[model samples]
Target chain A: MVLLKLFWSFLQIGLLSFGGGMAALPLIQNQVVDLHGWITLKEYTDLITIAEMTPGPIGINAAAFVGVRIAGVPGSIIATVGCVLPPFLIVLLLVRLYLKYKNLSAVQGALSGIRPAVTGLIASAALTILILILWGENGFSTNLESLNFVAFILFAASLIVLRKWKPNPIFIILGSGIVGGAIYLLL
Target chain B: MEKRKSIYRKLFSSTFYISAFTFGGGYVIIPLMKKKFVEGLKWIEEDEMLNLIAIAQSSPGPIAVNTSVLIGYNVAGLVGALVSLWATILPPMITLSVISMFYSAFIKNAVISAIMKGMQAGVAAVITDAVLNLGSNVAKKKELISVLIMLIAFIMTFFLKVNVVLIILFGGLIGTLKVVLHERRNKGGGE
Candidate 1:
């Protein structure tokens, strides 16, 4: 039953999470944290942290982590499969339809309209992450003032370099870790 | 026969490499695809690549998966799509399986934790930049309406903790209605 629940919950997440990993965060958080009580908020935070550091998409990582947490290896497989299945199915259907109506203006217009909405979804995702990072569990307390600005600077700088230069993300992630460990030791 | 064999080989090789290296899911795969398929192989022109991205974005699947299918199809039809999809998913599936095996030990590592913190900040920025670039490109009245709808959905889900499935359904309904109404107006004007 727990494995089934994990499968069903992640399946729902996969079906609805349109804008990708970052966009999937709040939904996954609500599921794991609020609905099932499978994981605590801190654990969710840690999962996000770990997912970001790891090699796959955040949504997939969350599924793997939560799946393992709930029902072990099988759980992970179930969750991952559940999360991936919806998109795969949906795309297959859309591809068929697209091949049929390859030049319909209505289809074209509808797609154009969706572009902005998708962008909006992406923005909302960014806002949610920002709030989580800045406010933490207390919801906007004086604690945010204590954020490691130096760490923030390094992060921002590394990202800027990444954007302009298009360096490999793995390098950036690993290098940032080293820099972070050094900073942690120094401070 | 020789020509067909070469095409199959190319398709398999491209799909295999993409599946192996793509970490962090679909979006991360986009840049890499741009590098490999567009820059490296010249399989698709930039315009076609951009159009594929736009289509993938508006479509109902994971963007990376969708793109791989589309690109693969464009290159070698159904066979290509199948190979690309398999390739795209293989790496993560294998990696996740291994990671799951040692999940507890991996999570407890302090150095991993520190690195994750740093990467989280960077990932956040990447997401932010994507939003900004997208917003700048598509910021108009209709776009604003879409943005507003998105904001409402976000607030409802994140703050009010409403079900995200409902939010997506509602967005889909609104999008459908807007398109239908616009089409009707256009028809009326034509008539």
Candidate 2:
């Protein structure tokens, strides 16, 4: 029963959340943290942090991670299948429509509008992550000492490196891990 | 027939291996797919690959999976599509499952926790970079309507806290309406 519920919830997530992996964060957060009490907000953030560190789309990693925590290996498999099912089927159906009338101006127009909206969604995702990194629990950080200065610095440095170098993400991720470990050990 | 089977097998393995290395989202795989399918295999033309990408972007799934499906379907029909789809997602599913088994130990370690913090910061930066890249490409269009849609969508989500699905729907509606309105204007005045 729990496995079934997990599948259903993630299926809803896969269906509703559009734009990309980042845009799915809020919905996943609500379902896991508020609705089911499967994980706390802090844990949810940590899960995403780990998900980002891992090699996969953020959405897939989150589903797999959360599923395993709630229902073990079977739970993870079911949840992942659920998460992927909607998009897979939807895209498959759309492929027919797309290949047939891809040249239509109306289709082009709709796509143009969607492109910018997607950008906005991605921006908001970054904002959400930024706030979480800077403030511990929620956006309401009363104590300044609780703020993580090292993370803030790392965020800036990472951005600069990415813009200037355009290096492979694996290097950046691994480099951050080493730098973070050093910070933890030294400070 | 033997050659065809070999090609299909190559597609499956190539997609699987490329997918395993995909660290971020679908965006990261686009260039890799181009290299593998376009330059390496010489199976699809450059223009055709671009067309597939455009279609994949407009479709409703992860672009990586969508593109893989598109290319596979183009090459070898439904069976190929299924094969490519499975290949694309297999790595992440396997990796996540293994990580799940040992999650407790990793979570408890202070060193891992700190490393995650740094990685989180790195991820935040990467997301920001994606937004800027997408936004700048949109800016290159130099259309007032597109800019308006972009701003309105941004404000609606960031400030008004409107649901993302609704925003996307609204964008589509406005976009279609804009195109229709322009068409009517041209027909009524010039023609």
Candidate 3:
């Protein structure tokens, strides 16, 4: 029964999470923290860190993390399955539809429109994280009181490295991780 | 042509490798997949890859997973899709399970948390770059409707906190309407 509940929670997460990893965090928080109280807000914040830090999708990582916390290995497995099931099925159906109607004007227009709108959501998500990291999570502020200059520097450096050298992004992430550790420990 | 069995193995291994190696978040994996499939393997065409990714995002669920399954199905079929999906999610499960064992210790570690904060800054950069790339691509199309949709969607999401699903649906509706009107206007010309 506990495992069943765990599965159901993550299943809802998979179904509802549309945009990307950052976009899904709130819904995951709502299910695991707010609704079920499976893990406290403190843990949810940690989950975000680990989820973003770790490989693959945040939704899958969160499911595995929470499942383990709640019900161990079996719980995590069940939750992970639940998390993936919806998208697995949904995308397959969409693929069939797209292949058939891809030539249609309506489909083309919808694709064009959704592409930009999706980009907008991604832009918003990036800003959300930037606000939290640079200004704290209370929303963007003009006071500059909580602005983190080190983070700003790091963000600038990473952007330059990415735009210029075009190395694998993993290198930038790992490099920033090291730089971030040194900066914060000194501060 | 390569044997179907070998192709399946290649697909599974490629996704598995990417899944295991990719860090930060889902979006990070996409460019890597494009590199592997479009450039490295030359199996999927450039526009085809974009179309698949677009559809993947158009549907619900994690965009990474959605993209992989679509790519897999596009390449190999349903069985290929299944292979890609499994390969994609397995790494996170294994890695997180181990991390969960040391959850408290991991969270409490000063160095790790500091690194996390730093990694987040880097992640923000990466994601911001991705946004810029996507935005510029939309801009390149030189379509006013999409540009306007992109702006409106940004305002709605950032300032208004609208659910992304609704925004996506709204975009789809607008797109459909634009094309329908376009077709009607052009119907008589039949050109």
Candidate 4:
């Protein structure tokens, strides 16, 4: 039952993941965290980190990673297959028809609209992660005590450093890991 | 003339090599695939690879895997596409399997947990940068309708709490409508 659930959830994720990998994050979060209760929001963020750090397409890596966490190797294979099967089939089909309508204005029109929406989708995803860091999932409650000042500070610093330097994400992630270990561990 | 079997062998081995070593995400692998197939192996022409990349990007999947399958199909056939897909997936599966083997134990370590907690901020930052970059790209396109749709989509998800799948469907529909109206206007004016 668990195996079937994992496969089905990831298959849905694979089918509708438009725009690109990062754009797919919110969708992945919705299925794994919101629907299946597979991982916490915090752990979901960490998985994004791990997925970003590892090689291959982030979506496939994520399916494997999340599946392993849920149910081990068999789970991993099943989930990974679920995640990839849609694209494998879709792309093959698209390639067959692509040469015909490669320049369809209606297609370009649809993309133009979807592209901005994907930007919004990523923005919304970023906001959710930001909220989780700054406040609990209760989402903007009146409690100041639960707020993580240190994390907020780090988040600000990271945003600035990324915009200014554009360092590779691996560095940003590892650097944060070191600093996080130093501050929180000592405190 | 290389035997048909060698084509699959070449696809598997070379794709495995690139996918194994390449880090980050799909975009990172494109150049490497280009270098190997376009420059080194000369299996595909430079222009053809560009077309494949564009189609791969426009399609609804991981660009790396999509590109792989396209290049594979170009090289061999459907079988080649399947082989390339597995080739692309195996390295990460191997790497993540080793990591997942120790995942529970790894999560338990105080040091690792703290580090990950800190990295969460980093992750948030990286995502923020993506939002800004993507948002700005849309903005740079300078379309009033596009910008409005972006804002409306953001408000819908972050504030109104609409399901993203619904938004994607609606967004695509609106996009098609936008084109149809524009084309109709052009035709009417021409007539």
Candidate 5:
């Protein structure tokens, strides 16, 4: 029953998470954090951090991470299959049809519509993730006690670094982790 | 039949290496896929890869996995698709399993906890950067209707809290209408 639930929940995420990993963030967050109660909001954010550091698709990594935490190795397998199965089948079917009518204006037009919407979806997902990071459980508290200044600074610094140097992402991830660890030791 | 088997083997091995090694998700994996498939193997042409990318993005699922299935299908059919998909997901599944075994220790350690907290903020920023980068690129197309669609989709998701599925469907409807009207206008002018 547990395994089945893991598969079904991830399958929903897989089917609905259009665009890419970033776009999929909200759906995954909703399913695992809100619906299933498999993990807390903090744990989900931690999973996201690890997913970024790991190789392969973030969506796949996330599924495995959450699944293992919830059930075990078997859960990981089920969740990974659940996540991969939808797109695997759908894309195969799409390719078969798409190859036949690759030039149709109507098909092209629908795709054009999807293209811009995807950008918007990605932007919205970004905001949602930031909110999750900054706000946490409390809705809104302007007091410094509620805010995490260190995290906000890191967020802004990482953005600037990413835009300016365009360094390898793995390096940035590792670098930030190290800095974070150092800060903890000092505190 | 034998030739098909070799192609499958090659597909699995190549995808396995790429998926196992590439980090930072879909965008990073894509260029590596291009190099291997287009330049190295000559399995697909440059423009075809671009088209596949478009389909991969528009299709539901992870882009890396979607692209793998598309390329595998293109090369070796259904069996190949299965093989490539397996290869793409294998690394993460295996790695996460290992991580899970040590999950308690990792989470409990003070340094690890702090690092994760800090990294979450960094991850958030990186995501923002990606959003801006993708948005600006799409906006650069300078097509008014497409730009309007993008804005609408953003507003719908961000403010109205609309379900993503509906926004995508509505965008497609508008897209189809735009094309049909444009085609009619062209025909009427020509006649």
Candidate 6:
């Protein structure tokens, strides 16, 4: 029963979570934190960190993580399958539909409109994650006001380097992790 | 024949290795994929790769999975897609399985916490870059409407605690309605 519930919840997430991982965060937060109570808000924050650090799509990672938390290995399989199945099916169907209406003006217009909406969704998700990192649950205390400017600076520099030079993300991740750890230790 | 065989072998090996090693999911893989496919192998051109990314983004599956599938299909055939999908998923599945087995202990480690904090910053940077890059490409009207819808949805979710599914449904409805209304206006003007 629990496995079934897990499967259903993730299937909904997978089906609806268009765009990608960041877009999926709000939905996963609703399911994992608000609706089911499988994880707390803080744990959700931590899971986002873990998911970001781990490989794969954030949505899939969340499904696997939440599934495992709810049940176990079997739950993980169920949830992963549930999360993946919808998009696969949808895309397969879309492939055929796209072929048929490949030149339709309306299709083009709709897609054009959707393109920005997707961007907006992505931006909103980024904002949510930033808030979680900065404010925590209490919502904008003095501590958050301090705002870890150094981290933001590092983040901006990393962005420029990534865009211009295009370094290995693994190296960037590791390097940033070390810098963060050292900063924490120093503080 | 020998050249084709070598190409196939290269594609298989590269996809397999990337799938096995890639961590932190789709966004993380972008830089890696760009490195391997765009920079290293030159299997596909940069503009073509960007187009593929756009297609992947608009499509439904995980971006990494969709990208691997598309790139693989382009390089080899159905086999390439299968190989790439498997490769893309293999690392995370195996790693997550092991991690899940010991999740309790894993979550409590201070080192892990520190590392996670750092990774979060990196992830934030990556996400911000994605937004800016995509933002520039977005058609101007789409950008405005999209950002507005996004802001409304974000406020609703973060503040009012509305269900996300509902927000998506509303967004879709608004999107569809906008198109419909535009079409009607055009038709009325033409008439």
What are the candidates' C-alpha RMSDs? 6.0, 5.4, 3.3, 7.4, 5.9, 6.2
Task: State the C-alpha lDDT per candidate.
Answer: 0.65, 0.74, 0.83, 0.77, 0.79, 0.67
B51 Cα displacement, candidate 5 (Å): 7.5
For candidate 4, write residues A51-139 as lDDT tens digits: 65566777887788888888989888998899889888888887787556757998767666666765575577568767876785567
Q: Report how large a share of the reference interface contacts model 1 reproduces.
A: 0.32
Q: What is the lDDT of residue B95 in candidate 3?
A: 87
Q: Using lDDT as the measure, name the better of candidate 3 and candidate 4.
A: 3
Q: Which is the leading candidate under lDDT?
A: 3
Backbone steric clashes in candidate 1, count: 4
Question: Which candidate has the highest TM-score of all?
Answer: 3
Candidate 4: give the clashing pairs. none
True contacts kept of 5: 0.73
What is the full ranking by DockQ, best candidate first? 3, 5, 2, 4, 6, 1
DockQ category of candidate 4:
acceptable
Model 6 misplacement above 4 A: A1-53, A62-79, A134-146, B1-81, B139-191
Off by over 4 Å in 4: A1-79, A95-99, A141-143, B1-92
Best by DockQ: 3
* DockQ of all models, two decimals each: 0.29, 0.42, 0.60, 0.39, 0.47, 0.31
Interface RMSD of 4: 5.6
Q: Give Cα distance to truth, residue A73, candidate 3, Å.
A: 2.5
Q: What's the residue-level lDDT of A59 in candidate 5?
A: 80
List residue ranges in candidate 5 displaced over 4 A: A1-79, A137-145, B1-64, B67-84
Tens-digit per-residue lDDT, B1-191, candidate 4: 46888989999999998787565566556656766788679999754665566557566767788899999998988889989999999998877766666765765688866876787777677767766766786788798988988899899988997766567656667888999999999999999
Query: In candidate 3, which residue ranges exceed 4 Å CA deviation?
Result: A1-5, A16-45, B1-10, B17-54, B57-59, B189-191
In the range A127-167, model 6's lDDT, one tens digit per residue, is: 66555545454544576465766577657777787788767
| Decoy 3 TM-score against native | 0.84
Question: What lDDT tens digits, residue by residue, belong to model 2 across residues B15-108?
Answer: 8977886566765566557657876788887546655655565545466777888888878878888888888877887887777778667667
Better of 1 and 3 by TM-score: 3
